[model samples]
Target: MTNSELAVKAVIDTWNQTIARFDSILDKLTDEQLENEVAPGKNRGVYILGHMVAVHDRLMPLLGFGPQSYPELDEVFLTSPDKAKATPPIATLRTQWKEVNANLAKYYAQLSADDWFGKHTAVTADDFAKEPHRNKFNVLVSRTNHLSYHFGQLILMK
Candidate 1:
């Protein structure tokens, strides 16, 4: 495979692996434990899953994917300053998490070499300025990086 192809494959693999790790963590939690916050400022497993889904959902669309089929991103990450805020039940959050992960994987798997290398402009929420963003390959890398960062937070909650 070409370098670009290998890069894209690496991104996809990393995303899948990280998401699977999140799922494995979630699977071990009971409904009550999913909502249990380990610290004053930290979120529980359910909230972390919801936040992960939201972040991926938003970033995917920015990379030319469709709107997330799940709840709003803010609802998960910004609903309240307190991490103990009420979130959806564990079962429902798990279903949504799975759906988002599947959608991201499907979209990412369909990317071609050109798609990975194509130049694209990214718009920040702060203003109308559009920054030159990396190709889809880099975007995928960022996505996985973002996921991994949040996954660390999730692990810390344990």
Candidate 2:
């Protein structure tokens, strides 16, 4: 395969691996454990889960796919900090996580190497022309780092 194809596969693989790590971690934690804070006076496991779901949901629109599946999550998980608003149940958040990622995976599979290199919805054409690095692939790479950051925090619960 070409270098661009290889690059796309590498990022996609890393993304899937990160998702799997979260799935494994989440599966082991009970709802009661999810109630505990990741650190003293810090965000709770439930809040983090909801936060991730909210963030990932927005990726759809940001990447020019469509509207979010769970815009409601933004208020509780994104706009507000932990305990600022009530979050969905652990079970519900877990389900939403699976659904959102699965949908994104389908969308990812549909992209060509050129599509991955194209600007996402958040960028204007002029800005993209000036800053070609601000593309869809960069978003995924940054988000993978975001997820990995949370993964480190979340694992503290175990």
Which candidate tops lDDT?
2
* lDDT, each prediction: 0.69, 0.93
The parts of candidate 1 lying over 4 Å away from their true place are: 71-73, 83-85, 119-121, 124-133, 156-158
lDDT of 2: 0.93
Alpha-carbon RMSD of each model: 3.7, 0.9
Instruction: Supply the global lDDT for candidate 1.
Output: 0.69
- Between which residue pairs do clashes occur in model 2? none
> Please, what are the lDDT tens digits per residue for candidate 2 over residues 28-99?
999999999999999999999999999999999999998999999888998888988877878999999999
Compared with the true structure, model 1 gives a TM-score of 0.80
* Model 1 error, position 86 (Å): 3.6
Once fitted onto the true fold, the runs of candidate 2 whose alpha carbons sit more than 4 angstroms away are: none
